[model samples]
Target chain A: MTGLKKTILGISDMKNLFQSLNNNYSIDLSNYALSSLKSRVEDFMFNYHFSSIDELIHKVESDASFFQLLLNKVLVETTEMFRDPEFWNFLKINILTRNNYQNELKIWIPECNSGEELYTLQIIIHQLNLQHKIKVCLTTLSPLNIERITKANLEIKKMEINCANFERYQEEGNLEEYFTNKANSFKLNPEIIENAEIISHNLFSDKIPGIFDLIIFRNKMLYYNPSLKIDALKILNTGLKPGGYIAIGIKESLDFPGWDQEFTVISESERIFKKIIRKEE
Target chain B: MSYKYIIIGGSAGSFQTVTNILASLPQDFSMPIFLCLHRLKHVRAGFVEALSIKSNLKVIEPNDKEYIRQHKVYLAPANYHMYFELGNYIGLSTEQAVNHSRPSIDISFASAAYTYKSKLIGIILSGANKDGAYGLSQIKENGGLTIVQDPEECQVKTMTSAAISATNVDHVLKANDIIQLLLKLQNKHF
Candidate 1:
């Protein structure tokens, strides 16, 4: 393991790197919460043996592949299937089961990382046999992440926690039933994502892909600064149909100004909110 | 020197020590306390309730981006790495765990050290692992005061011993003495 280094980047260094990335790749990370971003940038420097932020910027400007790796390193990907079992249970019983859809129920997972959450959602949909009635679209900034998630190979060690969470979420089945054990890892059944669409999209810089009934944008916003958070929320609001449901991480809240006016809290504990429909004045 | 933040990190056998420290502080304690104890990731509810029982000051697991308040105790939430952000707000992340622990002591302590610089007090208590050692070193390097529970008096000595080995920690005190030092600092006697 690489030893963690002291944070060496100052505010100006971070701004320069953000500016370089924006100019070269059109990637905008200016609004990420600074403290965590600084830590990650320092770690990246330490791991890759770069002594200065300018060296990192030079590499990012010169190599697109290295830039992709940087995206993978910078983005948070620590997620597990069926995490926060109580929230999953609430989502199943109170939201998914209760919603009555006439056409297809469109569910969007923006900034989908390594597919743990997507697989978890798919398992519930598979159990309910709602595959035909639902369409799931996953959007992420990293194409490598899209490939990795599509492959769906997970560490065998993680199964203990994953199984524990799955058991807590539902009573009857074993989580192991969903995957085939390999020598060192488990591969999720390909059928789980057979109908799911994976796209390389950036929520911050791109347009809203389509209107959706439910958006599971969990935990990703915790990285954004206040201004970016509100901007991202507005994009989510526009993509979600009025009366649609949006679920954030349990520890995340929609407490910023204008949130209450546009959305109503469905479950305060679980952080589920419903988009409010208002008549024109 | 006056302190603005009191950050504590512990695991394994440190709970009672922390409870005792929190139990000793009055409701109007001036500094905001940040506790980054290693906890079961799946179970989140009972720990805060258990700590709040003995604490005069309110003990909370703050939501992500929530503003920090003086006179309250903040516990790093389970399954997330807690950071002290700019503008005195709490930041949470589901990033990869460090030293096999989420709500990592190293991450929280380092962040606090960076944010508060010399206006921070970092303490490490009884625990079974070396998780907080690197973080305590960071606090010291940032010119903050550092303390480790007296290893001989600790229920588990590995954590404090590692911290002492990692840096020139300022004090190695027993549980009661640690509490007294905090109270002295609170009363502006230190």
Candidate 2:
């Protein structure tokens, strides 16, 4: 009966209706066009004073921008620096230090949500002292994500170092100490931002622009349907250079479509895969 | 004939599934029960709590070079793996995910099959992927009784189905029923 309840229910119903329509039409929601459509519903929901979610959806179908806002709300923002320590170790050992991508390393960290992963990679680069040497092109599914990363402020600086994770880092000789929170959270420097070219692209619809040396798109396939995972992987395969590496979140794998066959295990436990394409002399 | 070991693996819904299996297990049990569950990155040192909830066997994640003991449950710490070794312990590797799992069931099961041979009883339980299928089959190849949770009865069937499809499973049971199977096997020289 309350306005909040009405608004929530309205959004859910609208999403349900939208999803059903897409399903009926065999629409692939992974496409970039869905972003605009999602926004339209989000905008409609914002204006409604509906008492339930179902009613809110009914009221918001006509208005634009509501669904986008709703999608933002549903976005999962949970991430941490060096979320998995061993994987980074595997990267530092098996790929970063071993490979000659120093001046030419083009890393694409898709779905760089909430700046945690971006900062994480930055920490790795800083540790390896490759910040200015290697160029990393970061990509996200939403423009909002890029904005969140570049606009990352002093609030992050105030955060404290996770002593446990910091201890596990490869401890390369002659690097700055682990990050300290100045206040609120860690304040990121513009230099880190400058080294990385952040972009927004839909992996399922739009093509990934450049050839990448290492692709770390953690948790990319978790939100999608199974078919989308295969499609995304194909695109990823095309963009990655021969002998490049790709890392997924701990939960995801390339089993169904046999993507695993394309990669040699760098660290099978950390989900690191090296593209080992054959070349004829 | 003191060569029985228990191996269990899962993801997504593994935390709760392990709690049930460990609870069903008795303390001071004669055989060693080794467990591996695919965890999110940086899992806390909370495994002992889950294992202590029901079993008398002490539970803890293995250190990088730690030795494994009988009547104790050793969990592959987050981002690391647990492999069975013959010189009185399981070898922990900082290896990457085998089949998308750091503490891959297949890795643990395969190693157990190699070390324990017919004395091992491998069980594949709830999990999202097919990590343990091949490893369980390896255990079966070496003359061990292969027990898989019925895909229809599992909380998540992918791992169990992979196991069933890989080899002729000896027992396909539910979560609670697995405890019965364990007890049944333990009575026979374990």
| Per-model TM against the reference | 0.96, 0.54
Off by over 4 Å in 2: A1-17, A20-53, A59-63, A154-164, A170-183, B1-41, B44-190
Candidates' DockQ values?
0.86, 0.04
Pairs of residues clashing in candidate 1: none
| All candidates: CA RMSD (Å) | 1.9, 14.7
- Model 1 Cα shift for residue B163 (angstroms): 0.3
Task: Please give the range of 10 consecutive residues that has the lowest summed lDDT in model 1 chain B.
Answer: B181-190
lDDT of 1: 0.90
Write candidate 2's Cα lDDT for A1-281 as tens digits.
24442121223454575564365433335432222233334334555444445654444354445645554544544455666777777787777777675357888877555676777677778768877666777777667777778865534321333334555664543112443345455556666666778888766567677898889877555444445556777888889988888898654566547666778877666778888877788
Candidate 1, which segments miss by more than 4 Å at Cα?
A1-7
TM-score of 2: 0.54
Candidate 1 lDDT over B23-135, as tens digits, reads 98888887999999999999968999999998999999999899999889999999999999878999999888899899899999999988899999999999988999988
